[model samples]
Target chain A: MSPGPARGPRALTRLRSEGSSPEAIDQLLREQRVPLVEGPICTFLWRGDADGVAVDHRMPEIPIPLPLRRLKGTDLWYASVELPRGARIQYRILVRRGESTESMNDPLNPRVVGEPIGSQSVLEADGYLTPDWAYPDPTVVSGELVDLRLPSRALRRDAQVTLYIPSRMRRDRRMPLLVVHDGGDFLQYSSMATVLDNLMYRRLMADCVVAFTHPGDRLREYGASAAHSRFLTGELVPHIEGSLRLRGDPRGRVLMGASFGGVAALSAAVRAPGFYGALLLESPSLRFTEATPSGTFGDVFEPVVRFVNSVRAHPKKVTDRIFLTYGAFEPLAVPDRAMAEVLERMCDELRVMEALDGHNWINWRDRLLDGLGWLFPGEARLIYPG
Target chain B: MRQVTLLGPLDGVDLAAEIAAFGVDGPVALVTAGWEEGERNDAEVDRRLGGGSRNLNLYGRRLDILESDPGYADAERLLRTQIDELRELYLLRLRHALAGLEVIRRRFAEAQRRPGSELDAAIDAVRMLDETHTSSIAAAYEHFYAQNPPHERPAITRHREEVAAIVAGCAAIAIAGGHVGVLNDCLHLGHLAALIEERPLLAWSSGCVAVSERIVVIDDDDPAGRPDEIYDIGIGVARGMVALPAATSRLHAHDPDRLAVLARRCAPSVCVLLDPGDRLELRSGRLADLTSVGVVAEDGQVLRGAQAA
Candidate 1:
C-alpha cells in the first residue's frame, strides 16, 4: 500500500538543528527526490519503496529553510550541513505532531542516545574533543627489568630509563628492548608497570624490556631537541645494559612514546636501527614548526618524515618493526594518524605493519593491553574482562 | 581469612589494597594518619598480625611526619630513620632470597647462547623462577593478613551512627533501603556511598547530578550552551529536589539560568536546602517534616517534599 504524503521540507528544518546547512539540506532533498510543499510554512516530503513495499511516514517537512529531517531506522535524525563557514551557531530540535510535543524517543527516528531523552546533543565539528586512538602498549615484564640513563651532549640533560625484561628470551638468550620516552608519566599515568606485570603473567607477547626515559622538562625537552635522541642512543642503552644486566643485541631493542615523546622515539629509532629494532609511536606532535618563536617543526618533524620516506624508498639492511596508534579525540593527532597510514602503506609493501586504536586513554589502554597480549603471550590465564 | 576492619582516618589503606591486588606480595605496608589510640595502635596491629611470628610485618607511620607543622623537623628526622631501617630490612631479605635465582638466570642466558645447550631446559628454569616469585609474594601477604586482624574493628553501633548521619543529611523525605540506600544517603549527604543499585556506588561529579532529576551537573567548561550531556537521575529519595549544599559559593553561578528553570519547573513544590553545616531531614515529605539544623535558603523558599508536591 502507498504511504501518506511526503514531508521533505519539514525534514530539512529538522536537519538544520542537527548541524546541516541549507545548501546541504537542499542537496539531500534533491538526492532523495522528496516533494516540497509551499504554504504559510513551506513543507517537503519524500516517499520510497524498499523491496516493492512502500515505507510509511518515511516523509519529513521543513517549517522554514532549516536543514532538518526525521530519519527512519533511528530514533533521531541528523544533518551535516555548512553553517555560514566558520560561524558557530547553537541550535536545538523540538518534535511536534500538531502542537503536541513528541518525546525524545520519537516513534519515528531511532538514533542511539548516550544520554537520556529531552536533552539535545552538542556537535563539535572542529575536532577538539574528537575521539582518536593513539599510543601502543610498552611491553615490560616484572622479573626482566632494565634501566638506562642517557645524557644529551646537545641539550645537556640526563634522560632516565626503567625497562622491563620480557618473559620470552630468545633461543640465543638475547631479547628485544623498547626505549620509551616520557618514562615517569608513562609508568604512572598509563599504568605501564601494571600492564607489563599482567602481560608477563599471561604470556601474550615476546618478553621485552622497555627503557622508559622521562621527558627532562616536558615542554622544553621534547621538540627541536636532538640532544634527547643523542642521549638515548649514546648514553641510555649502554648504561641500561651495564646496570640492569640486559642483553645487548641490536635486534632486541625498540623506541617508543606518545605525543611529543612518540616523535622523539620514532626519530631515535629511525636514526639508530642498528641499536633500536622497533618504533612504537602514538599521537606524534608534528606541529613543531607551527608554534611561533621557533619553526623547529621543519628541522625536527620534516627530517623524521624524510628519514622514514628514505628508509621506505631504499630498503635498509636491518629490518625494523613499526607500530603506530592515535586517538580520535585529538585534532592535532589527525595528521599523525595520516602519517601512520602512510607508514602502514609502506610497511604493507614491505609486508610488516602494526597499527592500533587511538581514541582516548580508554581505547589506548585497551589497545595496549591487547597488543601486549598478542606480542608477549607468556602463559594463558582466563582473559580478565575489562 | 581474619577480617581486620580498620577504624579511623583512611590514609593510603585503599591504595595499598589496590596495588597489592596487582600482585605485589609480602606484608602490605600502610602509612596512616595514626589511630585514635595514638602510637600504641601501631604496636597493637603489628603484634596481633604476627609481625614477630610468621615474618609478616605491619608497619604504620604517623601522618604527622608528612603534615605541615612547626615540630616537623623532629618528625621528619624520626620518619627518615624508620624509612632507612625498613629499606635496609627489605633489601637484605630480597637479596638473600633472590641470590641463587640471579645466578640461575645468568647461567640460563649463557646456556641459551651456547652452541649445544638445550634451549627449552634453560627457558623452563627461568619461567619456573618467575612464577614462583610472583605467587610467593602474593601468598605471603594473604597469610599475614589471615593471622593478624586489625584492633579497631567497625562495630554495629558505629555503622548505625554512620547510616543515621547519612539519612539525616537528606533534604527530601523517604527512607530508602536495599541498593538504593547507600545511593540515597550519598546524594542527600556528601560522603561516597559503598552501594547503589546492587553495584558499588560509582558516583563522580557528574554521577552525583545523574542521581537527581531536578538538578543536572552542567560542565562549567562546556563551550556549547547545550545541556545534552546528562545521564538518568538516580533512584535516590531526593530525585525531584535539587539540594545545593554550600549554595552561596561562586561555583553556583555557572548556570544560574538552568538552576532557576529547574526550580521554576518544580514550582511551589521546589525545595532548596542550603547546607551551612548540619543535617536536614524530611520524614513524610511535608514542610513541617523538614527539620533544618544549620541550613538557610537564599533565592527560593524552603519547603518540604510533601508541601512542594
Candidate 2:
C-alpha cells in the first residue's frame, strides 16, 4: 500500500535459541501454514533441501537471491521478511545442490497464482482481500466474449481481438470502447470478463465494449513498434468503429496495457498524439539509459528507452487523461515514478496508484476497477456516485 | 405555522391513525414517485395511511413532461451533467477525507492521551468540506431554477398545476421512499417541497433524506468500499435538520468517532434518527416535539430531549 522499507515482528526469532527441539519446529510447520503470516511477518520454511536454499521472488528487484537461513541443529530453513499490510507476493524456492540450482514452488504452501508459463507460490499477508467485484455472481448478468479477427496491412498479420459485450447488449446503444493489449493473458490470468460482469451488475461502473488484442510477437511488437501502433490506429480502429455501435472518435476510446503492453500504448499515443483520449498503463517498462537497451529484458528495450527518454526530455500534452499504476516492490517503480511525474504535467487529468506488490497479473487485475471506471463512467455512476 | 410530522418507514404498521392525528380528515395525496414504475402499488401505502388515498403519479407525470417539452428536457439534461461533474469531485474528496477520519480515531486509541487539538481540527476540516459541498450543490439547483423556472414553461406548468390541484383537495400529503435520487427528482418536478408548506407532510426512509435540508446518503458496506457521501440538496422543507430514517439498524451508533463526525458535519442541522415507533414534529425550522426519537450531540453521543438552541 506504500513505498517504504517494511519492518514488522520476526515470528521465529524466539526459536533461534538452542533450547528449540525438532518436534516443536515440526509442529510450527504442520500446525501453522508455511510462509506463516503473523501481522506483516511472513516466515517462509523449507524442510528437504540440499546444500543451500533461497526465496526466489519478483519483489525488491535489487535483491536478486534472497537466501533462507538453516535453523541451527535442524534441517528446517526459515526466512522472514516484513511486508506491508495486505500485500500479496508470488515467489519460487531456489534450492542449490552443490553447484547446480533448480527453481520450484514452495511445497509447504498450497496457494498458487497462475502465469502464462507456469504458476508462482502465493504469499498473502493480513489485509489482502479478494476484491468483491471479481467473483462470478449469479445475480450479475455476465457478458459474452466473442472472437474477432482483423487483417493488419502494416503488421502483415491477422490480429485476434476478443470482444466483451454486456449480456443482452443491443446494437443501438453507443457505448465506450476499451482496447486492451495482451488481452488474452488478462482474460486467462485475471478473470477480466467476470470482473466486468460484476462491475456492471453492481453499478460500480458503466456497461461498455472491451476489445482484447493478442500480439504475435509480444516482445518485438509491443516494444514501441510503429507497425503495431499503425495496425491499431489505422487498421483495427477503423474496422471496430465502422461495425460496432460506439461513441464517435477518440473521446470514448481508451488504450490499456501491462508491462510491454503499456510501452506500446504510450508509444502509439506519443507517435499519434491525442489519438487516444485516455491511457491506462500498469508497471510499464519505462527504464531509460544513455547508452542503449541492453538489460535483463533484452536489447528489445531500445525503442522503449528512446520513447521514455524523449518523454522525460520534452514533456508535452499527449492525451486528455492518463492512469498509471506500479508496485512499490518492482524495479520498474523508479522509472514509473519519473514517467508519472512527467505525465501529470502532460495530461488534463492524471491518476497514479502505488501498492505493496510486485510486477504481477493480480496487481494489474485489482487496479482495473478504479482506472477503467474513472475513464468511461456509466449513467449509473451519478445514481451511486460513491 | 403549526408543524409537520415525520416518522420511520411504514412497513408492517399503517399510518392512518397518524394522518388522522395530524388533523387530516379528507383523502390523503400519496407521492410514491420514489418507487419509479411501482408508483401504482398504492394499496399497501393506502392501508398504512388508514383510509382514502390518491396516488399522485408524479414519476409518470415527470416522464410525460420530459416527452412533451424538448427544450425543458434539453436544459434539464445539461444541468444534470453539471451536477454529475460536481458529484464526481465531491465523492472523490469525501472518500479521502473519510479515510483520514479513521486515522484520527486510531490515533486517539493508540495514544490514549486526552484527545489532541490538532487531530480535532482535522475532523473539523472534513465537516467543513461536507458543508461546503452541500452549499455548492444547493446553489446549482438555485441556478437551474433561475434559468429555467418550471412554473413558467408550458409543459412543466401544466403538470405542476395538475399535481397542485390534487394536493389542494387533499387534507395532507404522504411520501413513501424507494430510490432517493428518483424520488428527489420527481419531487422537484412536481414542486412538492413548496406545495407541502400549507399541508402537513409525512415521509419516511429515503423520503426523509429527500425532504431534509441536505441529502446525506449513509451506505453501510464491509471494509467501507467508498465512504458515505453527501448526495445532493434535498427539498429543505424540514430546515436545519438531517433526517436518518431507520438509522438505528443501519448506523453504528455506538462508535463515538463516527457519531461525532456525523453530528458536527451537518452542524446547526440536528441529526435526528427516526426509527420504528419514533415520531417527530418540525416547527419554525426546529424540533418542536418528539416520541422515542434519538438525536446526535456535538460531542458524539446519541441523546434524547433535543431542543433547538
Candidate 3:
C-alpha cells in the first residue's frame, strides 16, 4: 500500500543451483513454469546455445540489463536474481547467438505484456495475480470496433482512431465517451477491448463510446502539446459529438492516459477546464520541482515538469472525478501521490489505489476496473424475471 | 398470512400471470414509488396487466401528501441525516470486521489442508458483523419512529389512512423495483408494510429489498473487489432472505468462494439469486424453492431445491 516495492522473506527452498545438466534443466522447466519466482529469488531460463544472454528489464530502482551465464557443459543458460516480493517487471530475454543476435520473448514463459514498442515477457513476483475480469467472456454479446480516421486540421494530418461501440448501444442510449492517449499500446497490451466487454457484461461499468487514439511522436506530442489539445477538443470531440449519440455533457466524457500520455490528458483538462468530467490517470509522470522525483527519468519529462509545476502553483478545478492508480514499485508512485493530494482537494471525488507491482502495461491493465467503475457506474438493468 | 412471491425484474410482464395464479379477479394495488419522479407512468403496467388488473397507486398519493406537509419533511430530513452519519461509522466497522475475516481466509488459503468447520466458523463471524451492522440501522429507524410515528401524526395520519383505505380495497399488491431507497422511504411514509399484511404480494428487484428485514446492496459482479454496502434495514414483510435480482448478469454465481461469502454473511437468512425468469416464494419465514433456484451455501457452494437454508 505504500509508495515503494515490498521486500519479502527468502524462500527456504534455496532454489539457485550450479552445474545443471541440459536434461535436468528441461525436466525442471517441464515440472514448473518458466521464470520460476521463489520468494526473494527469481530464476530465469533460456535454452538456446548463445554467445551471450542477458535480461532487458526495468526494475529494482535501477535500469540495467541482467546477464545470464550458460551452465557448465550444458546448453541451458540461467540467471537467478533477488527480486522483492510483488515486483512485476517486464523484460525481453536477449539471445546473442554469435554474430546474428536479437532480443527475444521467453519461449517457455506464457505470461507476456505488450506495448507500442513491442511485447515483453513478464516476470510477476509474489502477490501479483492476473485479474479475472481482463479476460474476454464468450457469454456476453460482443461490441464492435470500427477503424476510423479523423482529419485533424490542428495537426494537419489524418489521425487513426479505433472506436468501440457497446453491443447494447442504440440511438436512445447516450453513453460516456472515453478518449485514450497512446491508445494503440493500451489496446495491444492492456487487453482494453476484453476488459471493457467484460465490465459491461457484468454491469460493473456503463458501456461507453471509446475512441482509442495513438500518437505519432508520443513523447513530443503528448508532452502537454497545445496542438494535441486542439485536435481533441476542437476537431476530434466535435466530430464524435455530431456523429454519435453521446451523453453530450462534461460529466459524460472521460480522458485517460499513462505517463507522458497522462501529462497530455491533464494538460488537456487544464487548458479546457471542466471539458472532461473524469480523468483516469495511471502511473502518471507528474514530475515537478516541488514534487517527489523518485528518479530523473529522462529529458522527455521537461515539458511535463513545467506543466505540473504550473498546475501546482495555480491549482484550478479541472475534472470532477479522478481515478488514479500506480505501482508501488514504480518511480512515479511519489509523484502520483502528490498529484492525487492536489486532485483530492480540487476534484469532487478522487480514488487512489496501488498494487505491489512495478510500472508496466499489465499493472495499468489491472487497474481499468477500479478507474472506469468509479467514474461511470452502470445502473442495474431492470429485467423482470417471469 | 398470504404467501409472498419474490420475483426478479418484471421485464416480461409476469405480474398479471403471477396475480392470476392466485385466482384473484379483483384489482392489484401497484406500488411504483421506486420509480421516484416517474411513479405516475403506469401505461406500461396497464398494457402488461391488461384490462383485468386495475392499478391503485398508493405511493403517488403519499408523495403528494408528504411533500405538502412541512412537519413530515423536516422529520424526514433529520432522519436521513442521522442515518447518513450512522452509515459512515458502520462502513468503518464493517471494513475492520471484513479485514479480520480476510486473515482467516488467507490462513486457510495458505494452509496445506483446510478443515470445513473452521471455515464455517469464519463465515459465521462475517454473518455476525452483517447482522450487527443491520441491527444498528434498524435501531436508528426505530428511534426515529418512536419520536415521530407517521401513523400517529395528524399531518401524516389523514393521508396514510387514505392510502391504507385504497390498499384495503385491492385484492393483491405488486411492488416494482426502481430506486430502492425511494421505494423504502415511501413504503415507510405510507405504512404500507403493515397495511398490506396478509395480502398476496408480488415484488421484484428493489421491491424485494424493501420487504427484506436487512437491506444490503450486493455486487457479485466483482467477486474479488469491494464488499457489500450495508443499506438501511427493509420492511419486515419478506424477512428470511436477501433477494439478489439480475443475478445472472451481476453475480459470479459459479464462483464458490464468492457464493459462500454472500450466503454466509446473511446466514440462517438464505441468499437467493433472482435471475431473469427465476422466482422464489416464502411462506411462514421459509423459502419455498419451487423452481429449483440456486441459493448460496455457507460452505462455498451454490445449493438448489431443498438443500437451501
Find the candidate with the highest TM-score and give its number.
Answer: 2
Q: What is the C-alpha lDDT of each candidate?
A: 0.38, 0.78, 0.74
lDDT of 2: 0.78
DockQ of 2: 0.10
Chain A TM-score for predicted structure 2: 0.91
Residue A266 error, candidate 1, Å: 2.1
TM-score of chain B of each: 0.25, 0.91, 0.88
- Isolated chain A: TM-score per model? 0.51, 0.91, 0.81
Clashes of 3: 6
**What digit string (tens of lDDT, one per residue) describes model 2 on residues A137-215?**
9887678899998887888888899999887452213566788999999998988998888877655666778899999
Which regions of candidate 1 fall more than 4 Å away from where they truly are? A1-155, A163-175, A217-225, A286-318, A328-360, A374-386, B1-309
Pick the DockQ winner: 2
lDDT of 3 by residue, A287-333 (tens): 88864563455678777788888888888788787888888767788
Return the clash pairs for model 2, or none.
A1-A356, B14-B48, B15-B48, B16-B49, B16-B50
Q: Candidate 3: deviation at residue A290, Å? A: 5.3
Docking tier of model 2: it is incorrect
